[model samples]
Target: MLRLGSPRRRINIGLIGMTFVLSIFAGRLIQMQGLDTKVYETAAANQRTQIEEIPAQRGSITDVNGHELAVTVEAREVAIDPSKVPAAVRQKIAAILGRQLGKSEQEMAAKLAKDRTRYQLLARDVDPVVATRLLQAGVPALSTKKTYRRLYPAGDLAGSLIGFVGDEGNGLGGMEQAKNTLLAGRDGKQRVETGRDGQQIPMTSSQRTEPVNGQDVRLTIDRDIQWAAQRSIAEQVRKSGAESGTVIVMDVQTAQVVAMANAPELNLNDWRRAPAASYVNKAAADVFEPGSTNKVITAAAALEAKAVTPDTVYQVPDNIRCADQVLRDAHAHKVESMTFRQAMAQSSNVATVMAAREIGSQRLHTMLKAFGFGSAPGGGVPGAEAGLLPDYKKWSGSQNCTVAYGQGVSVTALQMASVYQTIANGGVKIEPQIVAGTTDTSGRYVPAAAGKRTKVVSETTAKEIATMLESAVGVEGTGQLAAIPGYRVAGKTGTANRYDAELGRYEGYTASFVGFAPADQPRLVVLSVLQKPKNGHFGGQLAAPVFKDVMTFAIKSRKIPPTGSAAPQVRMRAGQ
Candidate 1:
């Protein structure tokens, strides 16, 4: 700057200055990538690499015999890349999308015409063939994402019990909803390094936390028995023109619910088309008047209080008054002398009411509570209800008499089935268990033991009740239709009209039969309930036949032997 220079020297000075500026820029890059390496390296890695979660697959649902009930399979969701399509081909694309995705052709065309943006999910669950056609047709907009869809191999067989999944592949109903946490998978993720071009570099400081898949759930349900029960109940519902129906079968000893099914079932594969009512598991959720079924509980209370016995004679009248309530038999009867057992065998409401009176209301109420009425079965199934049981202190006098005969009290089918199971299991009231096992994330199996035992009635008392029940299958018994020839049958028939809230006075009826076969040593306890049958209102007529078919299959299928000698004969009907 102090010396004057020739023109060539000045030009060379300018050129040297420009070269020095370029060198400074290159040195700054070195500082960032080398000298100040940590700072820029952290910035670059943060900008280029991102941690993402990878979801593990959920476990399968199987039956007691390891038959797959519900399983998840990988599927795909397809979207359209509208921005890549030409305006000239928009209508063709729209028609193609309409045929594939079930979208309105005109609406899709309009949307394509107005938008150049990439379209996502213009279609989903596309058939592979359709996708191939799209590719062949050179439809520019289509993309796909791998996803999962739940498939029920058994379909409507155990849909209500196993439940169905939502569109998002999450559990929505039944066991699916109840054990979602144990049955659902969790995605895990970690940091990973990437190249400057946004490409992942294998084995380069990747932080990976593996995902844990959900546990496989095994239930006590028998697929064969479940299907049989569902078919039998559905056929009966259709034939009898009943509003609905439920059938339940439980192992007498294990309290394992072998089969529980309801009519009007929904196909799990197409659950969206099923009615909401079909989605409910009537066996666990619906509560109804026990009708004559309550009489058994009344008898239990009487026996417990030493108020009566099978031989104890009671002056059974056509009607009896306890407080202001007049108890009348469903059938006409005189003030004839009848033994307690005969009364039970005949299903006499007056006799049970008198016995309940002797036991007193408070004691009867307590026994009912202990028998698991007024409470949920704690079966661990979802949508289980604790049924209605009015406290004795709050009961009207009529409530006592009506409750004695199963009129005022409410109970679910599962609850009612368990009560009989307790009697069948010699007074041990075991909790009903459905799930058998569940596989953990590590592939280890966890056993389910919800059938914990607790004693309610004495064995001697249980045997007496069992004997009294057997008499119902006798010729004089109202439930003679329930008798399976060659095999002893012990069961009670219940017929109660549904009290209409709009127009009182017992509008419709629910007929039900709860019984055990080979009465000497009960193997299975089957309960079948029919709601509002158009053919007949009697349980023996409407539900007993279904029960017989179910029990017969159960007996033959289970290979249970006849109780006694002389080859007990099953009476052949006149049909064939």
Candidate 2:
């Protein structure tokens, strides 16, 4: 059926036609496939195989006993690729996205209308219910993807301590910020080859890197004890009408921080409503003049120097003068000369000043430093403050008297707790710790090192001090409010008036109490500081009760077996 051209004419015509057609085809192919490949191929990949980040699930945070503190949950993020959408459906796409995201359609449309950006985030951390609804609708240009979102299982139980993450999964405070690098995992990429009809090229996948999941962190906190301490403090804060309160508990044996609770906590899951102060860990941050609590150091120094004995009786006096300073007790009674034990039991400021004066500045400074004064607790967290303690050479005539009763120096709640813990642990002052351990991918834990210990006082001296503390908590002492029903308590009450610099005088007072319970065998050490309490200003009336409540709750929560014993008595040296 083919028609053959005239021999001469057909050859020339056919050759010319074939040359023109071949040249046209080659030019069209190069233009459509080479220079334009990037744009077109990207478009094709968008439909069939997206260039996306595959996020690994962040690890969990647990308490020392494997109690869950913070965990991760799957969340959905909705996005829109506006350029791929048909212009006619723009209004519909905007309406659907905006309503689902709690935004205005006009605002969403304006964002999607941008030509420069290929992808626009419509909503992040969307609830699964909304994500399901959006996905079911399947509006053009809209897409939903899965992501790992942090969640607090304990609510506000340990909120401030555990901390929370931000929208970009970055930590902002607490342990979240401290362990961010370990919590956030590495991301990965994939470039899958696609077939002609927008179908993924199966079995020809390209995955360049694998995601490395974050490590798990465990804290030294005991959840039950933490809950108990927090609840007790909250109850007391409400009942007493104090401005604010803080309580910290450390183990007598290990010196590990069992619980640190502050009132007005921020929710670990929802920190937006939290006040700035709510994020502050007051136990380790706020410093206050440590009233009569400082007397213990003075007493210990005198004991170490053999300056006085439990029965080394002193003459009775209504008041005493340390150079220009006049020292007196809360209640005045000119009794016949009382023994040193009786003087400590009555919490006589004059007696404490005398003890400090006898010990001298050098011995006092050594004892204070040994008690972890003028130093950081070194918990490895940011914002730790080292409280103030003047050196030995800095002591003047009145310095010994004022510092003896906790007036001249300042200390944080943590530092004060360490002071009490030292006495409880047989004079071995252990550094306080917050973090317990961090575990790698294999779930094997690497425990944090136990804090260093320093032997500050002798066991006999520690026992003597414990005996005096016991008398202080018994029938006729200032710390009577700190006694637990079933066990003996050893504690000191502090009532230091806040010094006003502008007015050059003391105005209000800060009430605090630091002590250990079950005096025979120490189970817990509790430090309670109530700032500017409106109802009453005495440490005995305010802070002592708070310490009692916290200590009782902590002991019960830890299920410490009650030794069920009577208080111990200190033996005075013969013929002192």
Candidate 3:
């Protein structure tokens, strides 16, 4: 607006403008390269670096003989970078992956349309072979991450005992849940520079932390013995049309559970389809009134207290009144005088109750507690219930007499088994064990610490009770069906009225048999229990045969020979 300048004047103005522009450039360069150099460098590195998780392998669960129960197999997880996928080939890539991943083409297309998303999961736990094949197809933007999936090779053989895993690779129940920390290893991490093709740059500096694989868990259960026990119980449950059943076999010397099986079991591989009730390890968790099978406790109590000798005699009645209640025997019979051995062999509730009265409530309670009642069995079994045994102070006169013959008190199957195991082990009540040990990274097994031992009765008292138990399984007793050929089997049959909470009264019956073989020198104790049998409710009729079948198998499996002599005969009637 001023006026046209001369050529020299115009040149001076242009030089000043150029100097101002150069000044701005110099200032900006200094601010970026000198002041915020680290900021720029970090930004560049972030674009070229990627951090990834390195998963560690979970441990395996094996049986006593090293048979695999639960194991982890190599697998892969497929993912997609939707934004990186080329638009022209999105449909084709989606179609190819959809077929292999069991997804619909429409679903895949919809996922790929999320262009703003950097990554999307296509499939998890894909078979490694299938993942490899998919990768070879050259599907754009498709990627794979290594992973593992748990598999149970034994199906549901010991399903409830072995337990299953959750989607995130955590143990959910049974031995798996109990030993999760030892079985789940630590995860690792890696950070490295990536090239434009999303591949790690060779010879580049990187950081990595190695993972620790989990140790193996070895159980004391023998697979073959477990199978035998399972088959026997299942067959009996089906034949008797019982609601359900449980069987437990334990080694007398170690008190280690050789077989713990429950009927209505689910295939562990398909645990998702199992009913909620089937998930419970009944042998360890469920409790019931042990019925006359608990008479052994009374017998042992009386003998140990010196209240009565094996030859002590009592005038038994079909029904006896005790504190506003009349307790009756399983069958009505005329009053008869009988020896302690005869009362036990015939399973006379009246005689047993009379003997218990002699022992007194407090002494009887002490014996029960010493035999591992009213407490958890401490077998390292998760969810093992401490069976219900009311405090002696709360015991009414009726309750005291009822408890003498295995009523009013509750016990888990494992606890009942331990009661017999105590006698079989010569009065030393060893804490039961399920998990034998755990393996190291190098597959060397470190045996578990020994179990605690408590003396429940004198060795002599135990032998005396064992002799009476032997007579109970002889030719003239209620538990005769529990006898094995050529073996002096010792056991008791229990038929207890099942308590129904809704009805607020005892309804139905729980048939059970608990015993050990070769009474002279026991090796194994087997307990079989059936709930609510439709065919027959008596323990001798419904449960004893199952015990015999399972006990025979256990005896043969362990290669235990028979006792050379027959069980000593006992008086079956009064004044014999």
Candidate 4:
């Protein structure tokens, strides 16, 4: 204490230390405000600017008459800014939102408790009106985003045909999946400047890329006909206790699909509840033997090749032998002398086999290919299968005879209907079509390109088959149940042994009826199919009634009057 320094020296030392500290701070300020100025400015801009994605509206699906099947409606996504919400009031606000949005209070509270997060989703796909009412509560940090949600207005009317969308708004099945690209438009983007509170800064620079909305798809389906077909098939499937069923109706002249219906169909609005198999359009997807319905092809091949005529006599017994197997008719009968027309009208398997032999294996195979078998039917339908048709060269000895009677070969309901449509169209086969066209950006309707056309047989051969089909619907024929009063009808019934893949054997029968109305001037073709029927397994008994109900409504709905021409007389028996 006695040897202290002078006052001037102490004062000078303190000033020097103060000057050093001030110089260090000055240098740091120069570096930050001048040398790294651009860096700091960029960081500030990044904090204020925000980018957002804008979802595009999905397109609509409509029937031929402008009925909505699938549509998009305005919706909102409710969210919260957890970081901005006060901890004391978080639970209260969450409870209010939970009640209004149908969410659990605890879940909403947990989302609100994420204090570090700026955004937390409360609910997606909320109704706009509900969202508006939710905001009227004036809860702090609550927000709503504009969005769109899919709606199936017709319920399950065309559920499987129209299909459903996923959570991300992508098509999942049916026409929705087949034409997804055209239906799902491109999304857009937007960039805007915001303030510290996360609110957009007014009058600030903003950037946006406009979204391209999806185009509307129009189908050839008639709503009324589709309803009738679906109702009738569903009822028949239940009454017959079958595993499944299908019905298809087409315009003979245009080859346009008027109605496609399946039992146990998917409900578009609630598709998750349905089984996966029900999601398929079975009419165009399922494959099975056509049984007697396929005899028309043999008849066509024989008539076209001049192998046999309608009056050709056959001494048919109840059964015939081929290779190691013996085939029999539907019912046991003694050897009978019948003309070709009578054999057809009676659904004689033996007679069909004899005619197939006249045409030979190669000629019959050629005729099958010409009729659109063993090929995928492209009609803008999803899961359209190319039915199985083994080459004649690959046919086993038994298969040759079996294929002649529609055993070894397989075909879809649509393919079989197309065959009848070809006959009804005077022998010209047109590719079946479901989609009529799509609307342009300007909202103008544009028709699709015409389907491919091929001449399958001569007009004369078609007329001969038509007459033969008419005999099958006559009073004495197996398909008499399919006849309509005052209308000339032509049809064939099918009852085939159903091959059960799961059981690894033939367990039941596939009953089907394919036919056309106004036989003199065909206008419509209808096909009905029932698989694994427990109550009954005859096509004429099980499937024909469904065809009759659907066909009667179709003719009446289309206002198709009878041709009023008398049916031509034909020889049923050889000596008649």
Query: What clash count does candidate 1 reach?
Result: 5
Predicted structure with the largest lDDT when compared to the true one: 4
Total backbone collisions for each predicted model? 5, 0, 0, 0
Model 2 segments beyond 4 Å from truth? 1-51, 82-99, 102-117, 192-205, 316-319, 322-324, 332-336, 379-382, 395-397, 499-507, 569-576
Pairs clashing in candidate 1?
Answer: 81-141, 485-570, 486-568, 486-569, 486-570
**Mind giving the per-residue lDDT tens digits that candidate 1 earns over 1-576?**
697769998899999999999899999999987899999878877876778666556779898989999887765667665666788888888998787767899867766765556565665555666666666777775666555567788889878888887866578899888888887788667677776433478877777898777889999888888888889999999998998999999889888888988998778888898888888888999888988877778888888778887788877788887776666887886677888878887888888888888978899899889889988888686787888899999888788788888888888899999989988888899998888888866888888766778888888888788888887777767788888888878888898877655575667899999989778788899999998888889887888877888888877777898978432333212111
> For model 2, how does the per-residue alpha-carbon lDDT over 1-576 read when each residue is reduced to its tens digit?
998768888789989999999989988888769878888877865666646677877878888898989898888998877777777878888888889889999998898788466688887888888988987887765667788788888888767777788887887878888788887877776666665433458786576667788888888889888887788777777877776778888888888888888776667767887787788777777777888887888888899899987777777576778779777877787754667777777788877777777878788888888898889978654356788888868776777677888887888888999888899888888888888888877778999888888899999889888888887787767889998898888998888887655578877788888899788899789988877677788888888888888788877777877788876545332244
Best by TM-score: 4
Give the better candidate number (1 or 2) by lDDT.
1
Following a full C-alpha superposition, what root-mean-square deviation does model 4 have from the true structure? 2.3
Tell me model 4's lDDT, rounded to 2 decimals. Answer: 0.91
Clash count for candidate 4 is: 0
Q: Residues 1-576, candidate 4: write the lDDT tens digits.
A: 598879999899999998999899999889889899999988988888999879888899999998989999889999988998899998889889999999999999999889999999999889999899988988888889898999988788767778888888889998889888888888899998898777899998889998888899999999999999999999999999999999999999989999999997888888978888878888888899899899999999999999899999999999999899999999999999999999889899999999999989999999999999999978676778999988899999988888877898999999999999999999999999999999988778999988999999999999999999999999878999999998999999999999988998988999999999999899999999999999999999999999999999999999999998888988999789
- lDDT tens readout by residue for model 3, 74-105: 89999888998888999998889889888999
C-alpha-based local distance difference test score of model 2: 0.80
Worst 10 residues of 2 by lDDT: 567-576
- Arrange candidates by TM-score, descending: 4, 3, 1, 2
